[model samples]
Target: MDGLNDYRRARVAEILADFTTLQFYIAAAPVDPPNQEDYYTEGWRALRQCAVDGQHILNTGADTHVPITKGGLEEQSKAELQQVHLDALGRRHQGQKIYLRQAAAQRWIELRNGILQGKKPAAEHQASLQACDEQLWLELAQITDEGIYADLQAADIQMGRWTGEDPSLRAVQRWIRSRR
Candidate 1:
């Protein structure tokens, strides 16, 4: 049991390190072309892999001779591991927001420059700008959803009950107040 616990801890540490690397990659990703899909794709892949690995550890520990108290501790650790993933998702979502905003701003600038240079902005440019706006809204919706999910998970951890309320309402209100 002790050996299994040690192995689980080591595996958790490795997953956390991988998550940290993924966060850094997400943060440093470029907003412009020659766009790199590999970075985003690989980061997501690594995150999902970490999740699978954590689940595997939990399942394996359950099958082992882990003591009752130790098993409870492992369960708590698993919850905390889930929180880490939620936090990573939040960070990645923010990074995507930044990238989308930058891309939109760049497109608008290009459109303005073209007008100033006596060239009508291409229809494709207009379409691209609109697409960026739509994408931003979609990303924002996803971020909000992730935040709500994280809040629910947090409530479950802290209160041990799943209350199906809109956890992000207060956060949204606070943001609105700050903007005002």
Candidate 2:
């Protein structure tokens, strides 16, 4: 934390505090019976390791010089937490994979339509999309759940559904618009 600018030093201090809190929670977590090839458990392990890595960065809570790093403890912690979320989402939607697939297709169409109409960024993207065959483009609607999930992952977009009693499409449309 030494030899750094005031802003960087403050940011590092905040990150370190977050790591300490995360470490405490990780240590206090109940022991879950291990499941074979469990992605959720693996994510927790990665997160726990990230907390431990932070301690190393801080020299076991001793004051230490930290150099600027893109792949530091903070970055790894965020990545691990995101993985945990994705894993949970996949598990929860296992039964409604078809629904998720359809939703993903709809999102795809929405994105492409925005780009093609110049409602979204990149005119070059619009030109490329315009050249796409209309019939072929609609084929995205028939993709498998795995295919849809792959697209979401590659795009770094989180996909999920609302189960609220209100069946209004407005909430969903607003969400899509925000993303665009």
Which is the leading candidate under TM-score? Answer: 1
Best by lDDT: 1
Instruction: Give the per-residue Cα lDDT of candidate 1 at 1.
Output: 24
**TM-score for all predictions?**
0.32, 0.21
Worst 10 residues of 1 by lDDT: 58-67
Error of 2 at 72 (Å): 26
Q: What Cα-based lDDT does every candidate model obtain?
A: 0.40, 0.37
Model 2: per-residue Cα lDDT over 1-180, one tens digit each: 222233333433433443454445434433331343322332233333434433333342221223445766665444443333332333222212333333343444455555556343356674555444343335534555556444534333232222212112333233223322
Model 1 score (lDDT) = 0.40
Candidate 2 has a TM-score of 0.21
